[model samples]
Target: MHLNYAHATRFNPPCPPSQYAGIGLGPRMKSAERFAGHRQDLARKVHEAGIKNPQVLQAIATVPRHSFVDAGLHARAYEDSALPIGHQQTISKPSVVARMIELLHKNKQPLGKVLEIGTGCGYQAAVLSLLAQEVYSIERVRALHDLARTKLRPFRIANLRLIYGDGIRGLPQAAPFDGIILAAAGLGVPDPLLDQLAIGGRLIAPVSKSETEQQLLLIERVSSHRYQRTALDEVFFVPLQS
Candidate 1:
C-alpha cells in the first residue's frame, strides 16, 4: 500500500515506474553477472566486519549496489568504499550501511516505520525497505532527490517515501518513528530528530567531534526525555546540512 502519512503533502510522490524506462545508464557492463559475484563478496566482507545479522547480510546481498551508482563507476560498485553520487555526496560504503542497519534491527523490538536522512542515490532507503515496514527518506538537495526518485522508481518499492527537504529539520509530522538513521555527520544529533523518536526508538548517525574526526554514534530513547548514547567505530561522512 502507498504511504499517505501525515507528511505526505510536503513533497510530491515519485513518478510511476513507466516514466523511468530507458533513462541512459551509460554503457552496460554485465551488471547482473558482476552484481551476483560482488554481492556475495560484499556480504562476506560485511560479516567479517562484525555485522552478524543474517537479515542484514541478505539485504546487502539482495539489493544491487551497482544500480545505485553511476554507470561509469559500476565496476567499483562492489568495493568496500563510498562512491560519489554528485553534489559532493557519496553513497556510503557497504560495511557502514550493513553495520548501521544491523544496529537498528538490534533494537528491543523489530523496526516498523523508519526514517532515513539523506537519501543520496536511494540505496540505503532500498536496503531499509527490506527491513522496515515503511521507510521515509528526506533529501535536502533537489537534484539528488529527483535523481533518486527516478533511479528508484523501477524498483516499485511501495513502502518507501522520498521527500525533498532539510534533513536536520526532521519530519515531525511523521514523528515517533521506530528508528531514524542519518547518513551525514553532524556535531551533535539534531534535537528535532531526538524529539521525533518514539519512547523506545533508536537513532544512528555519525557524530563529529572536530573538523576531521568523527565516530558512528547510536542513541536510544529510553524515556520521553532521556537518551543513552554510545560511540561506535570511527567513520567519515559529508556534514549534515540544513
Candidate 2:
C-alpha cells in the first residue's frame, strides 16, 4: 500500500475572547499575564546573548513556549536552555532559536514563505508564524508530528502548517521556499534542500564536523545553480534522520 504521509494540518486563528466566556477568562488571563513577564525576561536574556534583531526578540517574547512543553517543565520554559520533548529530541533554546531566525531575517525584509525541517514540539514553527507570511514544518517521527500538532492547536496559528513526513527529503510539493531551516544536524546540507530553495533564499542548519563536533552552516542560493556556504558557531543537535 502506498500511503502519502506528507499530509498537512493547518491551524486557524485564535478564537475571540468572547468565546471563552463559558470557560471564564480570569484564569486564562492570569496565566497569560504571568508568562508575559517571563517571556520579556527571556527576550532580554537573548538580547544580552547577542541577538540584536528586535523583531526576532519580539517574536520570542510573544510566543507562549510553555504550551509546547510538559506542564512540569513550564517553570524552565523561559530559560536559555533546551528541554527534552520526548523521542530523544529537544526543543532548541530560546537564544538559539532567535539567532537562527535572525539570520533568516538578515536581509531585513518581510519573509514570504518559510520551510522548517523539523517541527519538534512546534515551538520554532509558532515563532516563525509570527514573522513569515507562511510556514510549512515537517517532522519525520510520527509521535513527534502528532505531538507538535497537539501542542500547537490551542494557539491557532493560521499561517503555520504541520506536515508529517521525512524532514531529510524536504517537502518537494512545497519547494522553492523563501527560507529553509533545519533543527537537526546532518553531515552537510542535503542536496534536495539546496534545490528547494528559491534563488537568493537562505537555508540554515547544523552540520556535523566530526563525530562529536557540529557547527551552524548558512547556505544561500545566489543563483539557479550557485550557492554560498559559510560555517558558523559550534552547536549540537540530534542527527538528522531519514
Candidate 3:
C-alpha cells in the first residue's frame, strides 16, 4: 500500500485569498468561501486517490492549514507541497499526508489511543487528533513543539498532549497505543515504540538510511514482542535527530 511520490509529484497551487481566521484580517471573501474553495481541491484529490472516509476529507478541509505554517508561507498553505516549519523540518506535503492516513486506516478497524513520533509542526498531530481517540505526540525540538502548540491553539485539540523529547524512545507511559505514526525518517524501527503498541496495533513509519530513500513501513504488533510487516513505496524526509 506504499505510494511512491516520485511518480505522483504533481503540485497544486495555493488558495487565492489566503489568511488565517483569528490572526489575519480574514479570508479574501468570507472564511467559509475560501475554506470551501480549498476544501474542494483537497477533497477532489483525496477522493480520486480512493480515500473513502468522508470524515477524513472533512477534517482536511476544516483544519486551517494556514494556521499550521509560518506567516510568510500562509499563501502556500493550501498548496499540495511541503513547507518549512523551522528546525530544518518541513511539514509533509498534503498528498503524502493523505496517503499516509489512508494507509494507516486500511486494515485496522479500531483506532484508539495513538502515539505520534516526531510532532514536527504539529500539523500531523492535529490531523491525528481528529482521527484517533487520544494522541500523545513527542517532539525532539522544544521550540518546534511550542510553535506547533500556538498554531493549533484555535482548535483547542485537547486530545493531543505534546512532549518535547526524543521520539525514538516513544511514550512509555502511554504504551500499548492502538496506533502510532512516526513523522520523521529513521534508520530502523525503534524498539520502544513496538513495545508500546497494543497487541494487533499498527505503527507506520519511513525507514531507511538517514538522508536517503526511505521505505514506508506499516507494521502490526501481533504479540508483545513480535510484529507483522509490509513495506510501502519510497519516501524522503529529514533524518530523525537523536
Candidate 4:
C-alpha cells in the first residue's frame, strides 16, 4: 500500500499573523482565554497519567483541543477521552497522546524533524509542531486529510506540513527523521518507517495484540544496523490503513 511520489500531495497552511501585531483583543481572545483553564486542567490530568516531560505537558496545555473538535463536542474536548473525527476515526485521547510524545522525547534531546502517520483533525500534528522543528504528517483518507487541513489552517502552524498519502510507505524523500509517531494500531511497525528513522531516532506506535487489544511500542535506532524495541502501556487505536 505504498504510494509513489505522485500520489502524495503536500499541503502547507499559510503563515499566521504576528502575535505582537495587535491581534490579541476581541471575542476570539476572550474565548481562547476561557479555554485556557481547561487546557491547563487537561495537562494536569495527562501529567497524573504518567507523562513526566514538562515540555510535553506544556504543549498539552497550550494547544486548544476544543478547537480541533466540532462545536458540539467542545464540552468534552478537554476530557482525557477520544472523540470521533468522522471517517470512523477518533482523535487520540489526551493522556495517550501525551504519553506517546513523551516517549519520543525520552532521550531529552530536542527533535529535529518528526513524522506523524495519522493526522486526524490535525490535533496531534499541532502539538508536534510545538515540539519538533519540522513535522510531516501523512493521512491516507482523503476526506480526513482535507478535514485536518481545514481544521489546522486557522492555527497557521508554520512548521507543520500535511500530506495526503499512504503513511505505511513512510516519506522517503524526507528520510532520517528524528522522531516518528503513529496514531493508529497495526500488527507491527512498518519496515519503511523503521528504515526512515535516523540513527539515535525514536518511533512511538501502537501494535495490535489482538482484535480488541493494543500495546504501545517504541523503537529506537541505536546505530546504522541496530534498533531497540520496547513495549509499553495497554491502549486502543483505530487500525492503521493504507
Query: What lDDT does model 4 reach?
Result: 0.82
What is the lDDT of every predicted structure here? 0.81, 0.81, 0.69, 0.82
Please provide, for model 3 over 122-227, each residue's C-alpha lDDT reduced to its tens digit, 9 standing for 90 to 100: 7777676666666677787889877776666555454557777788887676677888888878888888888888898888888884455798989988887779
User: Model 1 shows how many backbone clashes?
Assistant: 0
Q: Give, for candidate 1, the lowest lDDT window spanning 10 residues.
A: 17-26
- Which model is ahead, 3 or 4, in terms of lDDT? 4
Give me the displacement of residue 81 in model 2, in angstroms: 0.2
How many steric clashes does model 2 contain?
Answer: 0
Segments in model 2 whose C-alpha atoms lie over 4 Å from true places: 1-30
For model 1, how does the per-residue alpha-carbon lDDT over 147-171 read when each residue is reduced to its tens digit? 7887676666666788888879888
What is the C-alpha local distance difference test score of candidate 2? 0.81
Model 4 per-residue lDDT tens digits across residues 21-108: 1112322455777888999999999989988898899889988898789999999999999999888999989999999999998656
State in Å the error of residue 61, model 4.
0.5
How does model 1 score by TM-score?
0.87
- Number of clashing pairs per prediction, in order: 0, 0, 2, 0
Give the deviation of candidate 4 from the true structure as CA RMSD. 5.0
RMSD in Å for candidate 1, one decimal? 5.1
The window of 10 residues in a row where model 4 has the poorest summed lDDT is: 14-23
RMSD to native for every prediction? 5.1, 5.7, 10.4, 5.0
Comparing 1 and 4 by lDDT, which wins? 4
C-alpha TM-scores of all predictions:
0.87, 0.88, 0.82, 0.89
